[model samples]
Target: MKDKIILKVETAGTRVDAYLASCLKEYSRGYFQRLIDMGHVLVNSQKTASSCRLKEGDEIEIIIVNKENKIKPENIPLEIVYEDKDIIVVNKRPGLVVHPACGHPEGTLVNALAGHFKGKFVPYLVHRLDKDTSGVMVVAKNEKVKASLVKQFQNRTISKEYIAAVGGNVSENEGRIEAPLGRSHQDRRKIVVGPLAKKMAITEFKVLSRHSGYTVVAAHPITGRTHQIRSHFAFIGHPVLGDETYGGPLKIGEKSFERQFLHAHKLSFTHPSKAKKVEFSAKLPKDMAWLSKKH
Candidate 1:
């Protein structure tokens, strides 16, 4: 069996494989290159190479070979913040994967939502957070709700606030990072800011407090790029503590962190069912709270 996807190029001058990876973040650029090699990708109704540069308004069609495996419901505990007919909001704990992928097939937030809903409606993911970043996340109950929330995110109308403790004392009280982000050429899993960057990423941050050599800051990402906050801070030489991938130290003096010291403190978006604005907030976990107080 196979599934087909069609996409229209919004921006020009990007490689086909890179464009595909940007549109579907679940898959990697290498995976798309393999698909193109296998003749499963077509541009403008003709089979195209992975290095093909896309023009604005170019049509891309992909045929993905389906696997037999399906996501199974698992009895995992979830901290439900808000629930309604249209959506469900959860304060996702750190270390929990948002969905199943190649390496992680179970024990994810999606599987937990599946089990929680059980015979009820299936959960539809609208957005995602990193595995090590604990945060407030929203899930749609149906496609209609998912479309509405996704559109809000696309239009940059949704508001997201995050708190993070980064290495080094930030001199600026408030500042904005306007950098372009894309997958690293050396490491596919990592994101970096440079000339090869494909998308514009913006993050505005304000210093909450200064402690020893570290600083606690509130970050608001204007663009919903992958690892936007983490990469932006790291680009400014202030990586989030415990985020070793971005050059952050694991141990700050006597204190040690198991995961990135970042949290999605608040999120605001218009309700899909009701035409009113709504907001959700999640408290900082024990480790972060303790570290903040100790320093």
Candidate 2:
């Protein structure tokens, strides 16, 4: 039988993960974060977030369950664009988590694909887009396709493009952000740019169009890293609209718009079989289209 522990918070505003770390001092914060991700930790009798703030007198429940996490295939819907015997391309929607990780193990795109393919779907993540970042991505059905796609990405030959609504009208029509990114020593959750950071990170952007006071820009990432676009833009003092993590400030975004106005616009890759270029595209989502054209 498993054991359960209950804790009461004496103060408010301590994050759920922080509180749990205090009670279970034996576990590392990263482990506590993993516990929060696996749904083992609950707040107020409901499944809440690791970042969730606790109020005084709030009750927290913890069950010492096994440390294994398995991805359960759930029957969920998916927006598939193109497919061959070797690979499948999906028009991933915003808020749709791509794979099972962190707090999202089930109800992910993988789960949906697993259900759609009826256990036949093999999920080979060629690349990743953030949970909130909507875009087009390809999944390989076999190892051969996976290896080819992975090589293309590693060689920086895959042609990928994105459109984003930023907080303000940028002065330059085009520019590149070259910075080294690595895990922040202070806050482990975020990536930091410094000379001590890892490999050269680069992003190229061109103003595509403007609307309703927000600038729609095309971003071509020469390198892929966690939150690269969001972080790089924010580093330049213009964060993407609606991305609170790296977003500068509320007033800054409100001055132009709301919502992370980013979209995966286009992708192109070389097919292993035909040795030809295959291209895919997704239209601008409704949130970015709510406003009329300005530029």
Note the clash tally of each candidate.
0, 4
- Model 1: lDDT equals 0.85
TM-score of each: 0.78, 0.71
- The 10 consecutive residues of candidate 2 with the worst lDDT sum are 248-257
Per-residue lDDT over 1-295 for candidate 1, one digit per residue giving the tens place of the 0 to 100 score: 6544556565779999998887776678998999999999999779999889997657676776663214467899999999999999999999998875435557888889888988476677778898899989999988799889999999999999999999999999999999999878786567899998879999999998898879999999999988889899999999999998898878878888788999999999999989899999987877777745643
Evaluated against the true structure, the overall lDDT of model 2 is 0.73
Cα deviation at 23, candidate 1, in Å, is 20
In TM-score terms, candidate 2 sits at 0.71
Candidate 1: the clashing residue pairs are: none
Candidate 2 lDDT by residue in tens digits, 12-110: 788888777765555567777887788888786688788899875466766656532133567787777888788888888888877653344468887
Which parts of model 1 are misplaced by more than 4 Å?
1-69, 291-295
